[model samples]
Target: MSNIKSSKKHAIQSKKNNQFNKSRKSLLRTLIKKVDIAIIQKNKILAQESWKILQPILDRFATKKIIHKNKASRCKSRLYLKIKKIP
Candidate 1:
């Protein structure tokens, strides 16, 4: 319970931002799952293709400040390594 009206408004805004961030987080996880599934199926081409699709979603999420840039970098790096290591 915010005492000041301004604080109340800030709390409302914070809730809205939290919802938006959660949606973005969900989308990121879904994209990651797509890549992981492709990798598990051992389809190198599919994994590579999924990575290309996932990259933009990741970049947008990072740009919106939903996730850290370095976190995105690490994820993309690991995916690339896995896809490349596939024979």
Candidate 2:
């Protein structure tokens, strides 16, 4: 679907970028799950640690455009709220 030589190169670049982004997104999800599991288990310390790990990953994903800026904000907000609810 590329029209020019540069476009073709761009296509390849995009593919590589997609692979990286996908991995990043997957890792973020896993980190979020760890946080959620901690919250659900009422492990406040672990939840805090997971949040520390997840925040930058969320920012990185937003920066890289794999996920929307607002989505990251929403997720972070919800995660914090859940953490607050934990004992």
Candidate 3:
């Protein structure tokens, strides 16, 4: 219910951005979960592979400001630790 034309456009753009961000976040969570599941299953090879895939995706999200850099680093650290302990 935006009255102004610019406001209407902004609303539409906001909705698109919101959807995009949500999908990205969901994908990030899924990637993390894949690594977690691999770790839980004690599959070291799979865990390592998933972790390798996850690290750059996390860094990209951090770079895009979708997620905090510290959070990304912390997650990477924890995942790496878990992978190391899998042996």
Clash numbers, per candidate: 0, 0, 0
> Between the candidate structures 2 and 3, which one is better when assessed by lDDT?
3
lDDT of 3 by residue, 1-87 (tens): 879999999999999988998999999999999999999999999999998899999999999988999999999999999899997
**lDDT by residue for model 1 (30-54), tens:** 9889989888888998898889999
**Candidate 3 CA-lDDT value:** 0.95
Query: Candidates' lDDT values, in order?
Result: 0.90, 0.92, 0.95
> Clashes in candidate 1: how many?
0
Instruction: Record all residue pairs in model 1 with backbone atoms less than 3 Å apart, i.e. clashing.
Output: none
Question: By TM-score, who's the top model here?
Answer: 1
What C-alpha lDDT, on a 0 to 100 scale, does residue 42 get in candidate 1? Answer: 89
Better of 1 and 3 by lDDT: 3
Pairs in clash, predicted candidate 2: none
Off by over 4 Å in 1: none
| Reference-based lDDT, residue 71, model 2 | 98
lDDT of 1: 0.90
Regarding TM-score, does 1 or 2 come out ahead? 1
* lDDT, residue 54, model 1: 94
